[model samples]
Target: MPIALLLAVPLTRAPYILSFSFLLLIYLTLAESYDVLSGYSGYMNLGHVCFFAIGGYTLAVIVTKFSSFPLALAFLLSPLSATIFALFISYPLFRLRGAYFAIASLALGILLYYIFVNPSFDWLAGGMRGLMINTSENRSIISYYLAVSIAIIAILTHYSIPKTKLGLALLAIKDNEDVAKTFGIAPYRAKTQALVISASIAGFAGGVYVYGIGYVNPLTVLNTEILLTPVVMTLIGGTGIYSGPLTGAVLLMIIQEVLWVKITHFHLFIYGLILVLVGLFMPGGLLRQTQIQKIITRLKG
Candidate 1:
């Protein structure tokens, strides 16, 4: 039903509607991607946005360098680059556990942000000025559908992971890494697999995002808010379940949109306060709240 509504959104021919829905799908894609590793495996990756940034910049560079290259082919390279980077970094990054891993990931994101914006890389990444691409007349609509496809893929990946060995390994590791290892679960391999999947989805989504906008810049792709939204949405929606990130993405996106439009002056403060309150009172997330659980039970009944 929701999918039907999303499919019909473009028919409205409303610019704001298309734009809003596109942004929502993008967030949903990222949140679900983040949930693949962090929600199931208990690895809080604060630098997950690094993949998104890399994906966007990669596509930007490709199009800039090979203007005649097929855009479809260039888009594919975005996720490939992100996946390669994730595979390369997973070894050392996965070695750290708990907050150490989280902080290191966060630092990694910051480091990449600076690297993309550095003057030395201008020939490739265009430095702080960013890269601009020639967008086609129908790019927005095409990108919107592409974003939808990636979001669907992310949702299916989240739904399907738990039924597989990797899923079991992730859940086991989340419960206790040492115990999981004793049970024959290769923690490093499982975690790496999850990260690689998450990175690829995020990369693809980021590519669609930049392609939609026809621009890529460090501030746009690697901003602090961009880095944090997926984490916040996944946590607030509830982890360890398929609906958690989806719930959080829809709820928070709506609330944030409303706040930004209505309470423009204090929206950020209000947003932060709401998150603080959720943390204090519903640390298990909205899905795990007793009231919500009862509601779900009633619906199922």
Candidate 2:
């Protein structure tokens, strides 16, 4: 509610204020979803954006072809498609641990990119040129609401999952797979569920993003920058708690927006320098600063 109010109030009634809020929500969802699997479960999935792209493309194909379906329905289906894809891939992929798992996901993402770009699949996805979506004039407002709702849902889901029996199982697996197996935790299954849940939310975000942007292509979907953005956000925000990703996303987005306008070409260099300094001085993330840690410690004490 506080976040919503912060988003609602503007220094001036500029449309860009709303747009920034919408983008912030989008990145928040993406970052939080990434945290679920990678941060909490200790499974590093480098292909998180693949699930996101799948969701966006799934909705795009559906809405573009069958204009009769409600946008909400299409949005729902996008995550379902992502879940199905995750289910199929998780079994084989979970066998690989750590770097191997990461590589496999990255490979899968690249493979999917190729598939989407293929001429044969062009009928479904509109090929390498991409599909342009026609949206209502109030698309920005609609997108803002949708993005905020999705961000809330993602945060709730992340918090809820870690408290359930299944979440306990996942935490066990994260701590020690061999020990988790002794307790019948089934690391593979837990990992798969985490992947599916994370991917589904990411895909849902993608669906909303497509509507927000009105167009998508291989360049947008397959870009390394898009894939890394959530990872960076998660790391910067601190990953263990619900607010970490949200903090990271907001901070990073603000920096990106403000710095890019002032120094376009040096933005990436500046971002890199920030990351380096953060790593050296505040390895736990900006949200995990000494002051915040002290407060948390005092509260626990």
lDDT of 1 at 250: 92
State residue 59's C-alpha deviation in candidate 1, in Å.
Answer: 1.0
Q: Write the per-residue lDDT of candidate 2 for residues 20-127, one digit (tens) a residue.
A: 787788889999998888877777787888888999998888888988989889999989999999998888889988789888887888888888899998888888
CA RMSD per model (angstroms): 1.0, 2.4
For candidate 1, what is the lDDT?
A: 0.92
- Candidate no. 1 TM-score: 0.98
Clashing pairs in 1: none
Which ranges in model 1 have alpha carbons more than 4 Å from their true place? none
Residue-level lDDT of model 1, residues 1-301, one tens digit each, is: 9888888888999999899999999999999999999989999999999999889988989988899999999999999999999999999999999999999999999999989888999999999989998889998899999988999999999999999999999999999999999989999999999999999999999899999989999999998878888988987899878899999999999999988888749877897898788879876789999999999999999
User: Candidate 2: lDDT of 21?
Assistant: 80
Candidate 2 at 94: error in angstroms?
0.6
lDDT at position 275, candidate 2: 78
RMSD of 2: 2.4
Work out how many backbone clashes candidate 2 has. Answer: 0
